[model samples]
Target chain A: MSEPIPLLMTLAYVAVALWLGVRARGSHRMDSLEQWGVAGRSMGPVVMYLLMGAGSISAYTFMGAPGWAWSKGVPVFYVVIYLSYLALIAWYCGPRVWAFGARLGHVTQAQAVADRFESPLLGALTSLVMSIGAMAYAVLQTIGAAYILEVMSGGLLPFTLNIWLVLGTIAIYLFISGQRAIGVTNAFQGGLMLIVAWTIGLWAAHRLTGDWWFGGVFERLRDTHIDFLTLPGGLGDMSFAFWTSSIIVSMFSFQQPVWLQWMSADSAQSIRRSASWLPTYYFVILPMVVVGFIGIFSLPDLERADTVALQLAFQQMPPILVGLLGAGTLAAAMSSSEPYIHGTALTWTRDVIRPLFKLSERRTGQLARYLIFPIMLLIVGPVAMLNPGNLIMILLVGLGFAAQMLPAFIGLFVWPRATRTGVLCGLSAGFIVTALFTVVWPNPLGVHAGAWGLIVNLPLFVAVSRVTRPASDATLARFMAIVAPRRPTSRSAGEREPTSSTIT
Target chain B: MNHRLIRPATRRGKALLALFLLVILAGLWPAVLLANHAVLILGLPALAAWSCLIILASTGVMLLANRLLPLPTSITQADPTKAASGPGERVDE
Candidate 1:
């Protein structure tokens, strides 16, 4: 039966993931903190390439994107544009972050901030912000993975059971091996995701546009669903400003805990190599888009638009591959979730608990390990089962929260005047305004609440920093040397060189 | 093939940076109204194709800029321990 084929494939995939996690502890002595936390900061181009690129593409790319395409149409293409911008951002920020981490022995994003500004309090707050986003993201992945399992299995699997099994499996693998396991599995999962997305997308495109195989449906959609082809979003669900603002926010929103993965690479060059290939990966959405566009024509009466992609695959594709599709979707979910859970654990140890208690590195790592399960079980697990809204909603809110950290980051390397008070004040103000507009105020002038919040956030950062005492020159010289020079069209000697009292 | 991150020094690299900024700016909130068009290209509407074009162009620019960086060694990530301790390579104001 079709049911068993997918279920069996999913189980096989789980076995490989577990095996990869166990074997990930190979050769490398993970006794040192960097080794365990960041795979010794030694991942080469191939591994780093897969790890960073994979982090950007989550199960949402497979699950929620198609649903957006099915309902909203042309706006879904924003996924490709935003990811392309994210890659460009890495080309700019990745090297600098890696340089700071490599030079300062910083393993986490918050550590970089804490060291730069000489404020452990700021570091803790930054990590807390990132942790909140990660938990939401992890839960989003859990819900997505569960949805794929339940939907693909034709009700043979239930959402509640699927949640426990998926989260439990992810937790075990992450707890055992840490970042190394994630890097290895990402290579496998990233490759699988690309192939599966291409196969299904191209196949669906060919089938749906039958007789007019190349793109006959284009003309047909123009005739009928013109609104779908034109944007501001289908049926005016999203305005033009919404699409544009979302792209700007999402592109720069790569400031999540995954910056740790950037630092884990063997060299900044590896991160650069990966960025070059990232735009191509964004094409994975092309197939998802094609499938969703077809679903608009084919599966019109479905209760939930999110179910369209899975339904079409089962209806049109052979039964044997449906299970494989289920597994691939699960891969998308796990690839992202594992890192988030680990990132949360690290943040708890490095930023919050360690700073307060002054624990040794080993003890901190132990405490980090201790918190992993409770985070998964008590927080992410519950939210996944009884989510407040759909997958995209949670994801958007998480992204908005992540974006709140950007001003602080930009200040760290770009402007010397950005003080601790400035960053702290700007961050809270931005978050409050964004949260208010996003949840409470609702449709603040038809723009994304985050966009409106940024209007308040950027200026506040600038104003507060101007009035506050700037960082000591020694502090600025060390952190600014790498990234300050990278800024386009800026060639000041001061920006390129450090103040004399520092390392030089 | 050169695995280096981008920098802005040379005329070519600066131009590439300009192109990247121009394109990204063109895609912001004000420009979204212009992007919403009904014309079709290979089964997608004009707006969709426009987004694809922006990404493709930006990728080309990024690749070009990275390839033109002055310090190849600086572009590559350094080993953590040496990087942390080595003051000789550190910049002097």
Candidate 2:
């Protein structure tokens, strides 16, 4: 149980990740913004599947879900519910997004929305809000990775050093290889995490309760802490209303800027195929949740609930398994963080900077490549070191903000009648209401603030669109022609079908 | 099972959508309350067991939908020239 074994194992994992990233750069020339941002839209189903699957299940799954299970109990199962729906949303939306990106060259989500409504100001606004959400997510992962490293090293690697180390590794590869690096590294990390999660989960359960199955663990919990098995969980704060609202908000929040880049696969079919299989990955959460429950009895009175799994590993498991757990947790954190970091730079430069300053595409791409450093070192690194909030709460807040972009999504993919003004007003209102309720009033009447925001947002959006002027017919036709094309009329059957060029 | 009654693809899509909604409702407030007992089913709590069942159901439906629907044509075919140049060139602007 020497400390050096765990530290060496973690360092080896980091080395492997860097190797995969550098190797991924060998396949493509990272010249353009499209290449750097979305891997030149050339990713196939396998890479896209692993990338999207791993990206969506982040440090939140490894740390926050276990933390919530340890602290609040069954309410943590809300993550399971929302994640299941997230795949369904991806199945429905991924194809449309891929089609739009392929046909129109959209590397970032804001670019598509801006073009749909023909409003650069809306694009800039969307970029700003999405950047805030992205930063929150990155910071959350950073803190989780640092904590794991510190514990696995038996306090040899301090949190401050670990935080910089985590960000530095991500920055180097992300700067060199971009989305290609993310795709390769995430695939390896994704496979590693699934294996490590199951091993730790079953081993922990067996060691704690003398059974590999979770039924015994639940039975023990039910007899002693009945509240842990039901809604409004152990803390009595996660009421049914809050749980339901959180699920709904999380479903919409799945459409983060990074996901759009992930969906920029070589074909719409690859995206859809990958999405249909993505939900199965949610099985990874079950084992992590079990680890958390085991912690309730095995490691009671832990200071930080998020570190319960690692703490338990150190106390009971052999040093090898402890080192493996450390590496797996870091994999989950870095897999999620790389995309957010890459997406943030792409969103800021392409959607915000380029359009605002009228920069050329070449210039924008170069700037985005360079912007990754300051974003990681100056912004995400410092905030993560400060450890601003709890793991799950930080995740929820970011998703709530990202969920405000629902109106823009409607304009892009579903309702063509949605005007620029309606989306602008609705997004602004939703963001304000969500922020106020989240920070000030804070989940009034046991309903999540995001749900309250949406309750106000939808009606206002519809009412405003009913009165305001919608997008120009050409713009609307351009979008409809891509997402929902008309069946060809007999008179026009003989002519060349109207492609993206017709509207333009 | 009833291709005569409805287009198989459309029916499958509807069924998939319906199953998704059912999972959501089953996992939420009123419906979840029905299974919120400490009672164990197959080595897990009632609600935990229910959540796992729905997750399995969700994966099954998605697989069924993928199999039923015809593979869509590549949308990239609409703009071969732009697709070849990579997704860097601005089409509309």
lDDT of each: 0.73, 0.77
Model 2 TM-score on a 0 to 1 scale: 0.91
Highest lDDT, which number? Answer: 2
lDDT by residue (A266-356, candidate 1, tens digit) is 8887777777666767777777776777888899888888777788888888766677678888999989888898888887787788878
Candidate 1 stretches with Cα past 4 Å from truth are A211-214, A390-395, A485-504, B1-13, B29-35, B70-77, B83-93
Worst 10 residues of 2 chain A by lDDT: A495-504
Cα-based lDDT at residue A129, candidate 1: 77
Interface RMSD of each: 8.9, 8.5
Which regions of candidate 2 fall more than 4 Å away from where they truly are?
A254-257, A389-397, A487-504, B1-16, B71-93
Q: Total clashing residue pairs per candidate?
A: 4, 1
The candidates' DockQ values read 0.27, 0.27
lDDT tens readout by residue for model 2, A323-393: 88889899999998878888889889988888667788888888998999999889888888788746446
